[model samples]
Target: MLVIEHIPAAIADEILVGKERDTVVMTAEERRWGRRRLRSSAGRAVALALATGTTLAPGAIIAVEPTWYLQVEAAAEPVLAVRPRRCGWFRSGRCRARSSCASWRH
Candidate 1:
């Protein structure tokens, strides 16, 4: 098991030119976590004990070994799209509910 306590600053592409790459896929919600155990696509166990307020971003390199480095990848999540029945309501600058007009204030 690999315990990662600190995340390094972004590494330039040239710096990792010859290194093999492995990835750990995490969900959007999981990316916000500062501490958790995860598995790389190569099946390596990785534990993150990052500081508070530390959030993992896509492509973030979490570990660098002799021959390869582990990076983070965000998993695709389902999104809900809501469309109003009447598009004219917004085109005319008028909301269906007057009580909610404050929400549309710009």
Candidate 2:
């Protein structure tokens, strides 16, 4: 009942023409079954987050099938290198230190 296109010609020909494999219809059936599984998995994920937390922020993931809940987190990705702080008295206008100091002129 489902018509899928945009497949590479070789794969499409093989799947539809029954030229290379005997279980062509089986492939499509498997894909449909997988989608149902994903939905169930995603629901379970949401339930887990809710049961564990008093305050819950819900989020979901849509892979090939819209079935999976991923815990969405916001985090700052810090750069690995130590960057020189930008100020008037340091090389390249970068001063490294926590306290405010008088400007050095060389």
Candidate with the greatest TM-score versus the true structure:
1
lDDT of each: 0.83, 0.27
| Per-prediction TM-score | 0.74, 0.16
**Candidate 1 lDDT tens digits, 1-106:** 9999999776778777889899999988899898999888989899999998888889899888778899999899998998455444566766655555544533
Task: Candidate 1: list runs displaced more than 4 Å.
Answer: 83-106
Compared to the true structure, candidate 1 yields what TM-score? Answer: 0.74
Tens digits of per-residue lDDT for model 2, 1-106: 2222212222222223322211121122233332222213223311121222122222212111122112222223445686345445566544445245344332
Q: Which 10-residue span in candidate 2 carries the lowest summed lDDT?
A: 56-65
Residue pairs in steric clash, candidate 1? none
